[model samples]
Target: MSKKQEQVLCIDRKTLPASWVTQRTVLSMDFPTFAATCTKAKCSFVRRGIAEEDRQKKQIIPYILLQTADGGMTAAYNRQGNEKRLHDLWSIGIGGHINPEDSAIGTDSFESILKKGMQRELDEELARRVAGDPIEFIGIISEDITPVGSVHMGAVFLIRTQDPEGYLPGDELRSFTWHATQKLSQLNLELWSELSLELINSLNPTL
Candidate 1:
């Protein structure tokens, strides 16, 4: 199959049956805990460190969430052996570990970190489908904190492009779609840190 076609057929690893899509009991958590667990595991690319400015220790991961003009968002879903999972089950933002090169040279500013994270994720996921340069940054939506037990802070960013119609999901993402901002409430998203949701919601009113 062509690269474009392959991406279109991609299904998130955690595909759930249609019956569970609107199931109230199943939709209790909005933000998936898998990422947080991955962060805590400290495996491979993931790492724990302290901020250079204030020396505040934090678990940092390079993450990106796509924000369209209509306030729609995109996320990757992790399929844990469920065939009936809905499209939303595999929905998660793009992101990974921030490598040494990402912070190399003079690119240590928050903006720099954001730019590097977004670029790396897009390149890795859409490399087969997109031929041009990387996607541009719209703005920083908010910085989120994980729950008390977790030692990580989530940085939510708002990003977009003139043409968002052609995103090809690689192994990391099963599929991609534009989810309405208002619908975010339907998902059972638990912020890792305190007030993370409030911060993100405040920054993006539609969320």
Candidate 2:
């Protein structure tokens, strides 16, 4: 059988410019409106390999940060078998690229497409672990200094779970564990996760 073509969303950074994106790494509260405005400009889907070559294109990354009922957060270590760039880095959020398949669900609204894509990713990555929990839009993330960061921007979500203890490490992760937000300093966090922790603390001072 032929290899399945992987398609992902791509938008020219120039065509859909966001001043905040290039200026900083994370924009916790102001990101949603900015991201929505950019997505409405010019966004399309192309093969993942092709998209990777286009530095001018910004690929969307929907990240879900799991907030456990016990007031701790869960993180996963990317296994070597995962994408080389992400291997060994600890990720506090779970997410992936927004693909062409996501837009096919219902393209009438851009927000709908994004939400569907995130839900699809959640189902594929976390399975029934977060089945009925409410997910909320938290913010956006960007890191233009790195090669991968140059072509991607993150849309983050926050979801509270009653039993995050049931979530197991599988797929691209070597292991998954829950930790107090205060203990993040002792862990090796991915760049995005580090920014996420900052945002979480800013919003929830008690954490």
Candidate 3:
């Protein structure tokens, strides 16, 4: 099948918790409560094209923010050379759409599925291993105002990785640099990164 015809994991917006506003980038939420409700909510694997246009369904993306123990973060896939709308903008997270391969849909709970997808994305993009114990859930991000954020939902996570050699990004993650978390505000960050910077600084350990 073509890329657009490929199926992706998605859940109905109504199935989300009351805290999930339709058009806001929410930085705080009860992760347990949200996870419990979502685990039981019915999800459908819809075609990518259709899912992108359906405001009723949310394509779940595990947006991972990688931070080192020394107080730095591995930034995004550089879009400077691309002809896309995000051109010249830097991304602060890595991860992608959850697929049927990551989750068995109705058979597996949302929490389990999300975990698998997060690991799969990390493994696929990085040359090193990302520890699972200290993963921090930042919050949910949504923006119905933008075309890309309109039909999608982001579950932001801050992962503590101890790569002594620093970040060497490739593939989907592309190229990245370990920037001091305190200096992130100086760079041109993507929308999600910009919106969540405050919370990240407050929650994640900084140098």
Candidate 4:
């Protein structure tokens, strides 16, 4: 929504020197290793859509999947935003880009920057609904086959909330609600959300 470009961090594949090596194991890659190998910069502003293809730029997305202890998970319908293309689609992940503000948090490690960014995004999207909950770092999610997935990489997190009741809708969401594990499969979900749901189901079989 801000017309001013959001200076988000990105890894420009073209800028990496031949001496630097990047592994295919992105999911298992730690943030320190990612930042060390790739050419990082606050260059990829949002909505520069096809620029990613031209520049071979990969944007980082901190995707947070929230769940309560009692097999209840939170999901929302996508609404107006930079990702308005996904409007009406259901998603279990809450996240966005790592902006320049994130860097101000700490540069001690790339992991720390991502953590701060994820927390900021969660707060903005969820209105601090799960502020007191514990968030765990999960693996990454990457799919280069699709145009959207081609330019984006997901750094996934799982947040466990103490409240098992339910959640209220936030500004960015058309609606938010808690669903039982058995009912999750019935709803139509976004492509990335399907993967996220599978991951959650695998970790918590009861859910």
- In angstroms, how far off is 71's CA in candidate 1? 0.9
lDDT of each: 0.39, 0.72, 0.72, 0.64
Candidate 3 per-residue lDDT, tens place, 16-119, comes to 76456466666665568657766677677899979978888888888888777655655555655322666777788777888888765558777888889888
All candidates' TM-scores?
Answer: 0.49, 0.86, 0.84, 0.75
> Which ranges of candidate 1 are over 4 A from the true structure?
1-56, 72-76, 79-91, 104-114, 128-149, 188-200, 204-207
Candidate 4 lDDT for residue 85 = 57
TM-score of 2: 0.86
RMSD (CA, Å), candidate 3 to true, equals 2.9
Instruction: Output the better candidate (1/4) by TM-score.
Output: 4
- Angstrom error of the Cα, residue 102, model 3: value is 1.0
Better of 3 and 4 by TM-score: 3
Candidate 2, residues 35-142: lDDT per residue as tens digits? 577666767876778777678787888888887765566555553543577677778778788776676754545676678888887777763574677788877778
Candidate 4 scores a C-alpha RMSD against the true structure in Å of 4.6
lDDT rank order? 3, 2, 4, 1
Tens digits of lDDT, candidate 1, 59-149: 3443455555444554434433222322234434455445545656743654454457557766786544333424432212112222221
lDDT score for candidate 3 against the true structure: 0.72
